[model samples]
Target chain A: MQRLDPLYPTCPIRNVIDRMSDKWSLLILSTLNQNGIMRYKELNSAIPDISQKMLSSTLKRLEADKLINRKMYPEIPPRVEYSLTNTGQKLMPAVGMMVDWALEYFDEITK
Target chain B: MQRLDPLYPTCPIRNVIDRMSDKWSLLILSTLNQNGIMRYKELNSAIPDISQKMLSSTLKRLEADKLINRKMYPEIPPRVEYSLTNTGQKLMPAVGMMVDWALEYFDEITK
Candidate 1:
């Protein structure tokens, strides 16, 4: 049997799973996956319903986790763009599986 | 592209994902998977950190979602036990993938 404590907050796996399971993280990752590299305004537009505060924080967390890359231009305007890092890109397949599962059971579960 | 809206509040897939992504649902589901059939008290003991309200509500949601089987037996006192439904069983592989990914990257992400 695996050693990590099942569902315990103290588990290291919980570090990733808990963060990933946050309200906006999966949505943000899914958005970035579909839209590719995008500027802050573009991402904000893409996910219009997210509060600016929430979006900014979620982006920071994803960046901190190294799941997404943030590029800052030294231009006077200081353009910032976001895209999935290699690790984040690789994570898409698993997210895709979850999405597929969601799609399959969406009606039954939600109804 | 999937017709489901990408990360929108109006989307049905969001209905499933958002609910599943709730703070306690994954933990509860994972516990059930690890422990097999368990009574309400057993579940409560297994995840000692979860509040009674949160655990009960999460269980109801999982049961309603058809991801868990809730069995009730009537004797002098009622006995209720919970286990994974077939659909929930199918979901384990995707969850396993995520757990694997988390295990591999936990150090980098958490550090």
Candidate 2:
């Protein structure tokens, strides 16, 4: 594969595309969108195939990107939950549309 | 990165996302979308940073996915052209919105 173009830094849309295209990000995003708030274990369980390491790192990346919220509570053992931020929530409809389009064309695409 | 799950075969949107996430495809599609029809050389020139091999393979993948059309004209030297198919065109407004969304969020996302 060609290395990322130097234009990456200057091109914002391409930057967004790169992030959204991270493979795991969309799956994790879609899961949170469908299930609302979830604990770390819940997110891990939602996608059984993802490795714990991948889940942890992707979660961090999403949190850093500010697409998802990672909230902590001070309780007996302490509680942490994950959910979409407002930006992440707003992004869902577009993602939903893309999912619809993908679903509609899946058979055609994979064959 | 984690190896893709066995679930990949069963997950259609994931598959769609995988294809779309190929790094070069979106850039190439956007180029074709804006410029209408492009010859191989034009496409190569349009994205100055891409290696020629990468462009050729991505074009083939797009054509195989039916997201773009590849046509050849017979002549002394022969000519080939590429453009989006109906499905690709349908997908681009979503991509455009994604670009807009990315542009809107770039400052926050990258820094």
Candidate 3:
């Protein structure tokens, strides 16, 4: 386990936690992890509540952060697919663990 | 790995993500995970920037969520120390992974 130096003004822990904790980003990453290589429409349908604007923006951010890769295929309509990068894949075990923990304590948390 | 049904509106994933994603809450949880039992002053000094109201409220929320246990000792000043519960301890590995990932990609993310 890494010792987080709390005194550091610009700690990477906070930056990474902030990104992972973003509800949409977390949900999106989890979704991508389960169903590999999702196009824009598939992603939108999978996460039904996300607005088109939000989905596009979030995807851009994730791609920028290198957590997900956006592949634009040269088709007549230009198909774009999104999937996790190696770094993103490495991060999912942690997410999976959190999901397990959440489900384990769901009743207590919701009560 | 839990299959998060994004279709499920009240998913535990979202609930957990929302709670964990709150910046102050994440920082506080990380601090408690690192420093074990901490009083209000210790916690305040550890995170440094959290306001009194925010710290008090965030701690209450975390305790209510069963993430941390707060013990108030009867003393001249009535000392209260905070530590993670079994569930919270269970969740720290995930947080630790996130910190590791963040540190690994700090320059890329910041650039």
Which scores better on TM-score, 1 or 3?
Answer: 1
Query: Candidate 2: where is the Cα deviation over 4 Å?
Result: A1-5, A74-78, B1-5
> For candidate 2, lDDT tens digit of each residue in A1-26?
12222676668767777777776888
| CA RMSD of all predictions | 4.7, 4.0, 4.8
DockQ of candidate 3 relative to the true structure: 0.43
DockQ of each: 0.40, 0.44, 0.43
Query: Which stretch of 10 consecutive residues in model 2 chain B shows the poorest summed lDDT?
Result: B1-10
Error of 1 at A77 (Å): 2.2
For residue B73, give model 2's deviation from the true position in Å: 1.7
Off by over 4 Å in 3: A1-10, B1-10
In candidate 3 the C-alpha lDDT for residue A9 amounts to 33
* Pairs of residues clashing in candidate 3: none
* Residue lDDT tens for model 2, B36-65: 999999999988888999999889888988
What's the candidate order when arranged by decreasing TM-score?
2, 1, 3
What's each prediction's TM-score? 0.88, 0.89, 0.86
Task: Tell me the tens digit of each residue's lDDT in model 1 across B82-104.
Answer: 99998898888778788788877
